[model samples]
Target: MSVWLENAIARANSTSDWLSPIRSVSLAALKDTPWPTRKTEAWRYTSLKSLERATLSPSPSVNQDTPEQIDGFESFNLVFRNGEFDLDSLTQPLPAGLMISYLPTASEEMKQASLDEFSQIKPGRHLFGLINDVLAQHVVRIEVAEGVSISQAIRITSLIGLNSESHTRVFVKLNKGASLTVSEHYQGNVESLNTGFVEYDICAEAKLEHYRFALQTDKAISLGGCHFKLGERADLNSTLVGFGSDLSRVDTDIIYDGEFATAKLNAFYLLDGKELFDLHATVEHAVPNCTTLENVRGIVADRAKAVFNGRIHIHRHAQKTLAELNNRNLLLSDKAEINTKPELEIYADDVRCAHGATVAEIDKHALYYLESRGISRSKAQVMLNFGFINELIDQMPNQVLAEWIRPQIRNRFAEMEVTR
Candidate 1:
């Protein structure tokens, strides 16, 4: 372990409420697992120099009077400032069948029960996850009882301010036949380090639609991941929109624990300048008749770089499984770079799975066709580029979400020059 991490852990031990066994487990894992480098397949195209060279510490407390709201959307909001939950900003009187509690305030019994549930989740050999276990300050828990459906969305926003580091954990549980829509937003105004981990356990026949927005400044460094386990016939729809950062990585893992589970993932990224964005996702089919579909699209401009890896695994007992993965990218400048890999592993002979990837630039003929109609070259190029991602944006679950995302993309295009 690095001296920096050792000191951080020592400081965390003085105040941590986690049981001794959990702390020991994290420390041992940190000692045995080496930090990732370019040689690591999962991190081959990404560099860790920026994160390792900086001094990272926990963020200070924040007091915000009012939570940020989405215009025209009647939603429940939870705000986290500088890695700590700002209870003062939350709306009172939570919806029926829903409970929202902070770990630091919960009783000992509640903390222990949450620890038990958290211990069952496997972070797939990520060192950052172990680090989070050691230093996370606040754990947010949300539970939805059986047969409950929330009509309004639940919005959770993470705002990082100044030079600080934060590790946050979230736990979500949905009982049988329950349904919920959750939107998570992450933003930072200054140079900072942020680590976020979320685990979702969905019971039989539950439905969850999760939307994530990573719109951080160019000075931020962010690492975030999500793990999901679905029970019998459950349905999950995950959608993500990411703008570039100095260094950012997002990981997603989904597994089926019962028969006939289904998961669909859709993602779009807009990268420019010298920003880097890395997205790694894996979907596992452990039971029969499960289906998984993943689609990712990206636009790279200037000297920005992006990495995408999508994997689908079908276990031997997972008969009659159907899965597909696709990644498509557009490069707007000669200096831009994109690395994409789509993979499939099927041990079941009865399963059908496929994976494909493509990277290309704007078509000159299309630009010329529009130019022949008396449109300016720059305007025509912007129109063509916008059309590339229009289909994906149209598939958003709600108009409010789409309205929230489109302006960012349009403003980005208006400020930059497009090249063939």
Candidate 2:
């Protein structure tokens, strides 16, 4: 075990809560879990050296950090400044049918139910996830009532400061026939460590639109996950956009628990300098008559590195399932590296599933065609790279978010200054 894990175990053992039973299980499992290395299949291409060497200490309870604002996107904001929850930042009087409560102030009934649901959707295969299960202090629960549609989205933002180590958790439940839109944002450019995880339970006929932005860069080390469980006839649409950091890794899992459900996921990333980003996704078709569509793309420049492992599992009972995953990456520098693996595990003969991955440089022919015009070579290079990821950005359902992110992606290209 790494020194970090040892300290985490000690810290987790030092505290006890009403959910101690649940935390105990995680703490025990964490003690038995060994530190991951390059030999670990799930972490084969991503290194945790940055985390192991990071200093773990108590962070300030509050900071002046504020969440990012979207001009046209109206949302109820919940901010976590440093490792502490900023309850004052929440836009209160949450509309009817919506409830937001934190661990420290949850009602007895909420606490009881939270114990049973915690970690139920997220698989235990993740090493950092287990640590999150144990060390997370800022646990927030959000629920939407049955048959209600929340038009205004709820935004959860975590702002980390320099040399801080923090863990945060979110649990969202969309009851039967409920509809909601939620976004998770993590923005920190300083050197720090953070673990943020969220789980969603979408019940029968419910719908959820989810977005996750891990935009932290530079020496920030962020490990997080978003896990979803879809029930009968449920619907889920999720979008993820990220910029690379020293050790930025995220795991996303989509599980179909009931029949006739649908999930669509799209993710894109941009890496520059020595930053590294790793994305691991798994889709579980545990029932019949389900459908899944996933698209992932990335651009790596300079000495940056990116890793993608996407898997779609079709169980034996999941007949009539349609699942497909496609991952494509662009490496603009000779020293830049990308490792992509798209996998399909189908035990049902009646299922249709496909997975593929490709990593390559920008098309020279396209560059030449653009240069044939009056476009400079450098300008042409940025255009080609931008065009590759713009396809996915254009697919974002929220035009407000898409427009906000488009210029940021352009600014990233300018900073990268990647050349042929």
Candidate 3:
């Protein structure tokens, strides 16, 4: 085992909490699981050398860090600064049918409910996820009552301080026929590490609109996972946006457990400097008549690297399943690199599934068209890159978020110009 994993195991063994029994299971599993290397199929393109000898500072000096402000986005915000939950979030009045509980101080009923639901949805395959399970002491659970529609979105933000390491987890559930929206945001810089994971259970006929933004950059190492299990006729729409950092890896999985359920996932990552970002997304069709649509894109520049692995799996009994995945990439510089794999594994003969990937540079025809219209070459490049990602950004159901993120992407394109 690498020094980092050994240290993690030690640290995990030192803690005792209300969830100790559950943590022990994961801690044991983490110990037995081999450290990944170039030969590991799941981690072939990503390296963990940065973590092998790393020293962690578990606690941060008191600082009132907060999430970035977005104009006109009204949300009930749950903020974690250096992995410490903000008490103000609990003081705010919540809308009916919404319940938020912090595990450490939860009531008996809430704690019992959380005990039953925690760690049940996310698969045990992720290394960082197992680390998160063992080290995360503070847990948050959010639930929407049956048949209720929540108009306002619930936002969860994790802000990591410099030179600190933190782990956090969240569990959310939507009962039968309920509707809700959730937004998760993480930001850290200056040589910090963070692991955050979330799981959602959507019951029959429920609909959930979700967004997760891993916006940390420049020296931050962030790892996380988001998993969902859908019930009969359930609908899920999810968007994940990633910005490259020193090392950033995120895994997302969607499981269709009931017939007629549908899921749509749209994701993208933008990288600059010498940063690295890896995203692994999986969609599982375990029941019949399910549908899935996934689209992922990336832009790499300035010697940065981006990795994508998109997989769609259809079980043998999942007849009439429809799934498709498309991945596209644009490299801004000759030194920039992208590794993409789109896979479709179908066990059912009647399933309709297709997967494809493409990697290329800026479209010269489009660039020439813009340049001929009197736009500067550099400006044309920025415009072209912006247009490449804007299609997916514009599809964001929340126009406010789309408008908020567009300018940032445009600025990155200009600052990190790539020479083909």
* Candidate lDDT values, in order: 0.82, 0.89, 0.90
TM-score versus the correct structure, for each prediction: 0.95, 0.98, 0.98
The residue-by-residue lDDT of candidate 1 on 153-267, one tens digit each, is 8788888876778777888898999998888888884678888888889889999989888777587888887888999999999998888788888888998998988998999
Error of 3 at 26 (Å): 0.3
Tens digits of per-residue lDDT for model 3, 254-283: 999899999999999999889999999988
Candidate 2 wrong stretches, greater than 4 Å: none
Model 3 Cα displacement at 266 (Å)?
Answer: 0.4
Model 2 lDDT tens row, 1-420: 988788878888998877688889988888788788889899899989988777656654346787877899988898887778887855477889998888767788888989999999999988889988888877899999999999999888999998887789999999999999998999998878889999999999999999999999988999999999999999999999989998999999999999999999999999999999999999999999999999999999999999999999999999999998999988888999999989998899998888888888888888889999989987888788888999888888888988999899988987775554
Estimate the Cα RMSD of every predicted model relative to the unseen true structure.
1.8, 1.2, 1.1
Candidate 2 clash figure, as a count: 0
- Counted clashes in each candidate structure: 0, 0, 0
Rank the models by TM-score, top first: 3, 2, 1
Instruction: State in Å the error of residue 236, model 3.
Output: 0.7
* Candidate 2, position 332, lDDT: 88
Pairwise lDDT winner, candidates 1 and 2: 2
Worst 10-residue stretch by lDDT in candidate 3? 50-59
